[model samples]
Target: MIAYRNAIQLGDWIVTTDNSGGIGEKMDDLVAVPDQITARFATRVALLEQWAAGAEPVAVLLHNFSGNASWHRYCEGIRDVFDEIGITMPPISGSSETNMSLRQSAVAVTLMGKQKLESSESTGDWYTYGTPLVGEEVLTKESEIASLTVLDEARRTGLIQRLWPVGSSGVLAEWRAATGNPDCDAASPLDVTCSAGPATVVLLQIDKEKLPNAKRHFGTLLHALR
Candidate 1:
């Protein structure tokens, strides 16, 4: 089941759903919002007023009740309309569930427009490599160095162009071996630059506990790209 609402502020608008009840209870239900859903809602909430008056783009949070493709398509349609109207669109990320007792599935949609991003400076090319500190570290070091080379090459060729120091020593060993110079401070959580076009890349050393934080961290990296 799905419920919706719409509004407009001056000229801009928003359309949202009210599907907060347990997933099973609402799965088969469908409720239609107004035709000018996006516009009316945006206006009612003052989102359009702010945007039309040249205010910075607003951050929108959307939680989907169903993880089906049809729901995603509907969201896309609304996003397309917003894009045509020149409003800044930010990506919506959330999870969907089948029932109250069922596991949840996640869904995400990327929105575009001009807006301030928090982690802008952290954007850059990234290369990562890691080696478990186990017994007889000699063989591990050799294997780790080889793996770092692969990551370094990915950065050089632009396949993986952002840097986060999730694993520094492993990465540095590769960088040091590749350049044949120990001057490159691969240990530092600083960005490294390529002499050519995309100058500097941010390096990060990440592990399991840091995985959940990647989204926000990477979001900042992407903001820098823009």
Candidate 2:
């Protein structure tokens, strides 16, 4: 029998299976792990050993939406254990687009310790960080819309925005809108432009005064643009 352990998020919430054999059926209330202590692969390995017993090694699939150094480190820890057990672990996969059937199984690990798909200042904005806007896999139109929605929410939460790159045709328009200083004709040297969508390039300019605060909201974006 392929017994499976619970799905764990980076911050330490565990989604265990209930007696109904249903996957991700939250049995007990969500338990909170201490802030200082994160989950260790050793604990995961022990749980897997007990669940699988003497049966053939089960395939442990780790799903992530965003690929970052921290996630890489966590996976490396898992790999170490799998190597010790002499089992060929299943390939790790990532997807920014969501599939209804795989909802509970897909684990999202963000540095912010929040599950919401907001842009991270530390990680930088997705586009600025040069991290693929979505996962590498080709997505359907619907999935693309969903992905955009995630960004939109982030923008609304003051976590992200589609800033115009400098030197673009719309620079004047964006500047006017952002700074509300249309009468001032100050030429900006950094004339970089970012394509907001097909046939639409926005002028990108950053206000130095807002840099520090913006960095706190979307460091990845600043990194990419900088």
Candidate 3:
């Protein structure tokens, strides 16, 4: 239920969306940050969901509530995420609310992608990539966040059985839910229930026998769940 929430199957396509609010350069926002950074992380979440599902993204829809002036900067942020995956920015179409003044900033990104095929099953262990980071911590701990480039390459090489992005539920929660092992008490160095904020962490199902190669492939980004 956790992994399946973001992206859904629609015949040959998968449509997914992700959102963020109150974390921008707005007067009443919970976390004060740039609009560009806000949109970038929000876009990254939706794109990662599509990518993890083996979908080739075709279009993007953005909803901007910050202000009319923030639209262009939001687009730039979205494009920045696309650049990280080494793909051309998809056509973006959305609206901006400029009629009234809003206290907090809000944004949502929806991605439409074609699912080429189903993913393979792994006969190995589950591991996490990146530490759970939320709000201001996400801005400061850039090195701990998972890499889209690395994930893209791993999916292409068939090195992972399944890829699950960690959201607000944290690593252990996602792992247990995805594996259907609700009672699993795996040793973890990370907080089991902290928010991952825009999916900075991802759960990778890799064959136990291939752990060596996975270590080489993921480098320092990989961490054990057990």
lDDT of each: 0.31, 0.30, 0.84
Q: Candidate 1, which segments miss by more than 4 Å at Cα? A: 1-46, 49-54, 101-226
What lDDT tens digits, residue by residue, belong to model 3 across residues 1-226? 1235568878768888888888888889999988899889988888878877778889999899888988998999999999998989999998999897688999898889988766555477888888899988998999999988998888788787778889997887888877889998767777768899989999888887777888998988788888
Off by over 4 Å in 3: 1-3
Writing each residue's lDDT as its tens digit, candidate 1 over 171-211 gives 45434543346675554332332211101122332333434
Ordering by TM-score:
3, 1, 2
**Candidates 1 and 3: which is better by lDDT?**
3
lDDT of 3 at 151: 85
The CA lDDT at 11 in model 3 is 77
Worst 10 residues of 3 by lDDT: 1-10
RMSD of each: 19.4, 19.1, 2.0
Candidate 2, superposed: residue stretches over 4 Å from native: 1-50, 65-67, 96-226
TM-score of 3: 0.93
What local lDDT score does residue 193 receive in model 3, on the 0 to 100 scale? 84
